[model samples]
Target: MRNRINEEITLRKLEVLLAYMETGNLAKAAEALDVSTVSVHRALHSLEEGMRCALFRHEGRNLLPTEAAHVLADVATDVIKAMADGIRATRQAAGYSADHMKIGSLYSLTIRTVPDVVIGIKVRRPELQAELVLGSNADLLFKLKQGAIDAALMAMPEPDPEIESIALFEDEIYFAAPADSPYARQASIDLRQCRDEPFVTLSEGFITYQGFMDAFRIADFTPNVVMKVGDIFSLMNLVSGGVGYALLPGRVRDVFAHKVTLVPLSSQYRLRQTIGLSFLRRRERDPNLLALAAVCRLAMRVPS
Candidate 1:
């Protein structure tokens, strides 16, 4: 009997019941629901018939809920709230007047790539605002998955199934030291030669850090990392101060051109990092976000 009763209940009937509960009169409930009084009365009758009991009893001009109706009303309230939340989420996902787009990126690209992308997007779509979040690759990926950020620019290809990535550019990694350092005068330095020197590098989870380690491993030596920092600026600062040298991307060299001297790596392994733009595949079809991505690709000169 309960299963049969539950099966007959519809969301529309529940909504009418809630409206009646709020107004205590059919005419007013219909007015609140933006329907004719007859429609409201019919919905109430259907709800009562489906439940196999009278949900409300008219006392004079007022209607009062029966015990079953009281219980169902509580449940209906929760269900209605859930439905409303679902609607809100759906609307948000559909980009219905959403004010800002949140973007995440590794610190290395934030100084150049991200700013240029933002500028280009604003130039094209002046009404759309961009919020930028800067962090490590792992941190940005985590934030993107959690929906704290809409998209991210980082080294790729990421193996996460939830994310879809587009290759932006391939940047070569070069060994850099202070201009007066012994290695600066050389056209290139062998990875094995730097094995004994103290190295300043990005912390783990960064592509550059992994590339540096891999380069050393390929050269049959392990680097002595004296310090691990979060951002390239700090790493370059350390290198400038001669605390230690580092393996950095060519983009970093472009940004910090005069601060340090970059020496090419004489490795056959082609120590290069591929930058990519990543976002959830589910969100890949969002028109606004797609447009923003298009502008970003244009700004970065990422090949389509």
Candidate 2:
């Protein structure tokens, strides 16, 4: 008779055990399940813990299933098969099979990067709709965590244990100023030079805003910030009208180049913002997320 164990064993754990039972090796089980060997090992360990029994015994170099393992594996076969239909129904109920993919990003990206990426995705998949949400780095990451959005494009998002991110590319941060300003005429301006300059900045909590503050910190001076706006374009418009100097991404040079100058900074003040794609790790297998990520990676390469 098989020893009774804890009922906390999950369907995913059972699926891992069934894969291992049929394959006879970790590599084979991982390959069949399309997961890393580490994931397989972890699931197997959890399964053993849940059942409160040693399921496999080390014999020579092989891990052979024990009597308990054999009994659980026999029952797991039917359970795993039944759960497949259950998963499909649940996914449908959760709108996982929706036609549109909701993508979240900062307000600044709307000018160039985000639009191009959406176009690129549609070019590849004509039927797939792209829904965009613009917000601060904090907002986008929160929606991603809550599953309100499938993915997010953010810069140096605050580290969270529940979310996983892949940095897509690096964009240099530039000090934005009027074309005729003394700072613009210089070959390179130090952040120290801007300490007395009235600055137009994005509202705090934005990654752009954070980078702006980092430069000030490195320069050991507080900036005379005169305005804190919500979006990059608004900040640029104010800078164009000569309200104040602002720090911006190099990507904005083309759009504002007519009235503004993208001056390079000294090494001390130069900061490259890392733009990353983040999604719930559990949904890494979703085809829509995979496709959008591929498009975004490609879009970052083509000049915006």
Each model's TM-score, in the order given?
0.69, 0.68
* Weakest 10 consecutive residues of candidate 2 by summed lDDT: 91-100
Model 2 alpha-carbon drift over 4 Å, by segment: 1-89, 92-95
Can you give the lDDT of residue 27 in candidate 2? Answer: 92
lDDT of 2 by residue, 209-296 (tens): 9889999899998899899998888989999999999889887887878899988889988998888888887777777778878888
lDDT of 2: 0.84
Deviation from native of the Cα of residue 115 in model 2, angstroms: 2.3
Model 1 alpha-carbon drift over 4 Å, by segment: 1-89, 93-97, 302-304
Question: Residue 116 in candidate 1 has what lDDT?
Answer: 86
Question: What TM-score does model 1 achieve against the real structure?
Answer: 0.69
Q: List model 1 lDDT by residue over 68-100, tens digit each.
A: 888889999999999988886886775443557
Using lDDT, give the best candidate's number.
2
